[model samples]
Target: MERKKFLRNIVLVSLAPAVWLAACKDTGKPAAQAGEQATYTCPMHPQIVQHKPGTCPICGMDLVPFDKNNKDHSLTLDNSQIALANITTMTIGAGDLAGFKQLNGRLATDPEKTTVISSRVPGRVEALYVKETGVSIKKGQALYRIYSEQLASLQQEYLLAVAQVRQFPDDARFAQIEKGARQKLSLYDQSDTDIQRLVQSQKVDPYVTYPAPQGGVVAELSVTEGQYVTEGGAIMRLEGYHQLWVEADLYPAEAVKPGQTVKVIVAGWEQEPQQMTVQFINPALQSGSQLMQLRGTIPNPENRWQPGQQANILLPVKSKNDVLTLPVDAVIRDGKGTHVWIEKSKGKFEPRIVATGMENYDAVEITDGLSAGDKVVVTGAYLLYSEYILKKGADPLAAAAGHQH
Candidate 1:
């Protein structure tokens, strides 16, 4: 019993020291260490950073904490982190708003507005009133003069027939000759003006003048002074300068309805862009491209908007009553789906899957995945994703490599 008591005393003594050492190991070191300062940097310019958080001077952007766990975080020799970074952000919120299906394309002409100029009678041109394309013309304005042997002979026969008709008032030969002469002259564009003038003057007049039917700019000028033009031959192409079209290529699922109002951003123009609507949509997709054509009609009063000009089209879709939207660069696209990083606080970000809808170059519609008040890591989403990849034992390269959703 004394030996057992002695062994118990020894064990108690040993446990007392161990208990004290274990308590000592848990001193406030960890809690004090956890209060370390966080490092922050701008997403747009990674070179920018500060211990005291602030914005970038080059561009106004809020600084976010640099986290190693971010899937977008990458090692670099500059002692600086390289990762997916953006300076832009927006909120997905509930409100009355217009949704859009955006597309990029070039300015084009409205086929309906283009007018082809042709002649009714075949002849060789003697003189061209308009010398070059782009010249404005007016209705009833003389565009050119043509001399045709057929017209000259027809005029001579009409003059003779008119004189013969007047010489015998009741003779059937006179009436028949006059009727044939009038029909021949009419076929050559001898209008009532020309026919009446010939009858009154009792003279044969040859060379004919053709007038423009409508006023517009001469888009194409095929006639030199002496070009022989057949009847119905193309003489010039005239297009109204007051209105035009903007055409954009669209994917199969893009919503584009005729008469739907759309906003247009004209590239390389300083003037305020015009608002218009869809004029038409090609039923068949373009061969080899598999892209459908969407068109919008815009007024060209100042001639500022020309056909073939490059443009970014913002087509209004449905009105997303109350939802969240963010800058397109704010979300990181993963193989499974699109994800965003929600900033919990300093040095903490959580990965979140987001449901997306209509996405334009400027912003994205957050359909079912986000709320109006949730602050997300729009600038450093890729950085946060890096952490998720690490925890899942997944390849960061695979995530970083892009796949369009």
Candidate 2:
């Protein structure tokens, strides 16, 4: 019986160790279950991990299933790295925004201030007092001389009429003849002084001098010394430089109102930008180009503005009172499409494809891919884009970046 007890005790010793090992294994089951209880993490801030689904504490981004397969759109940067990259962000919201439309234009002479010098009667150009274009002349200055047989015949008729009037002063027929002769000379652009002189001297002059009608610089001279010209034929073009016009083309979508002030920047002129008031806008569409014409006048009393110089015109486009806007710097452009970097959480950003509309110098209209109160990376968007490219070796927004149209 004692031998049987010893064998039984050895068996009990073996069974006790097995029971203790089983107890130790059972104690580890809860820890293993806890470790595998559906882990979650931030897609943007991958360092944020949790045992269950919840919002990230640092960025308020929703925690997604921790899957190693989908890491392309997600990026995580430490505090030090973010500081070194100089990253910044802004919360977009609905507000009043102003848009602008930029256009190209050219400086030109004011048409109202231009004068066309033409011949009043058919004659050959005898002599030109103004030699070339750009010659400045004053009002009443002799511009050219014309020698005409018609002028000479009128002069001789006046001389004979004056003789008849002096010989038969009491006859009304002689007075009528003298009046007819004076009328013929006046029709040929003969000045009153010249006519009176001819009557006093009883002489006939073949050539008559034409005086400049206005004071300005010659812009175009088409006549030579011996050219024959007809009545109303343009001889030259004179334009005043004290005032100028800035003209530009407008598309059908653009709206312009008279008296609205716009700013103009001359390409090569270093002076401060000039404010030009809207002088005129064509009511009908331009026939050939189908574009509308816009005009603005600028004072140039100093003769500083030159015609045909390039200019940049800025037209203020009206904006809605309440609309979400993103800074222009926040947007990214690639062959794929227009996009922006959205801060899903602090120190985390993801590429978001967006549709855009009207734009201005500083901001752009956000039509899609975001909502009000969404955080956007405005300042360091380019840096984030570069980081995404380097990390993924491909564009994060390639699939959705292509032109949607």
Worst 10 residues of 1 by lDDT: 73-82
Give the residue spans of candidate 1 off by over 4 A: 1-95, 268-279, 318-405
lDDT of each: 0.71, 0.82
Regions more than 4 Å wrong, model 2 = 1-99, 287-290, 318-405
Tens-digit lDDT string for candidate 2 (120-177): 7778999998979998879999999987877788789888998999999999999999
Native-referenced Cα lDDT, model 1: 0.71
Model 1 alpha-carbon miss at residue 182, Å: 2.1
Q: How close is candidate 1 to the true structure, as a TM-score?
A: 0.55
Candidate 1 lDDT over residue span 275-364, tens digit each = 888878999989888899988777877777778888878776666555567877787774556777655443444456678886655567
* Cα deviation of 20, candidate 2, in Å: 52
lDDT of 2: 0.82
Name the lDDT value of residue 150 in candidate 1: 71
Q: Number of backbone collisions per candidate, in order?
A: 14, 1
Q: What local lDDT does model 1 show for residue 62?
A: 80
